[model samples]
Target: MAKRRLGGGLICGLLLAGSVLAAPPTAVIIGTPPQPDWTQLTPAQKSALAPLSKDWDSMESVRKKKWLGIAERYPKMKADEQNRMQERMREWARLTPEQRAKVRDSYKDFNQLPAEQKQTVKEKWKAYLSLPAAERQRLREAGKSVQLLTPPQPEPQVDESLAPAIVGESPASPGAVPQ
Candidate 1:
């Protein structure tokens, strides 16, 4: 009985030790690095990210890092390129969540397209965006109108004479005796 008790105790100790070793590590609480103050941001960084200023502090740390990276690169970009980035950022901010999802899905689909088709889509989209706002709206309306006005295919016709012949009877002509 004593030997059995020792064996059971040994088994229990081994199981406890195994569980201790297999347990996941506890999360360590460590001091996070301080976020940069808005004033501490470089003038160029502030300017390039102006639209985000109001919500900057509320942004996640990871997002702040990403914006900081962009800000760092912004000064090196050409004027036109910087303008394009700013415009894109503004547009992104203005999008609803559903709209953003659509953009993301479309981007993923575009990335999966063949290179030539992707280029064609890119060119067409650029051309579409380059038009004045009113012209773009008018073009969209025209496209809808065209879709609505499209003529449908005519119904298939069966010649009455051939129809009777197919059924093993002659179609009687006007003022003629039926055979």
Candidate 2:
């Protein structure tokens, strides 16, 4: 009778242990606000972030929150500021992930420069914007070519064993005479 009770208790414990081991982990996110779906956004947010509507659901929560904050502040901005912001949003929406990452890195680098250096960069950008359309196009083309000139990658190794046998070739011997 005592052996029976011990065996039953051991079986119950094994079952409980197996269940605990098989269960998926439950994540508990604290403090961070939930990212809303596109349909969950307010009308003003939808209007302000129209360019990102197609991609809204797929964006990271932090990026969604950042854009939401921008949308919230959109109404208070001046007309020129609103227009600039809209244009930038559209441009941002069009950028590839790699391009966006590069732009973010560049922005971070720019922000870290000293005030005077930042001012110099702004002045240089303004000067570049002031140039003739044709001159700017030429400069852009030159920059693109420079960017395209990356170091060549090494050729991939071929597995001769797995390769298709060439006509008139034998597996046992090289340059074997055909029978």
Which one wins on TM-score?
2
User: Candidate 2, clashing residue pairs?
Assistant: none
User: Which stretches of candidate 2 lie above 4 Å from their native place?
Assistant: 1-31, 144-179
Per-prediction TM-score: 0.52, 0.61
lDDT of 1 by residue, 3-45 (tens): 9999999999999999988979889986546668678788888
Model 2 lDDT per residue over 1-179, tens place:
99999999999999999998896988976755779999999999999999999889999888999999999999999999999999999999999999999989878977877777677667767777787989778878788422322223447777787443545567777677768
Look at candidate 2 and tell me the lDDT of residue 110: 75
Q: How many residue pairs clash in each candidate?
A: 0, 0
Give lDDT per model, in order.
Answer: 0.76, 0.83
Query: How high is the lDDT of residue 115 in model 1?
Result: 75
Off by over 4 Å in 1: 1-40, 130-133, 139-179
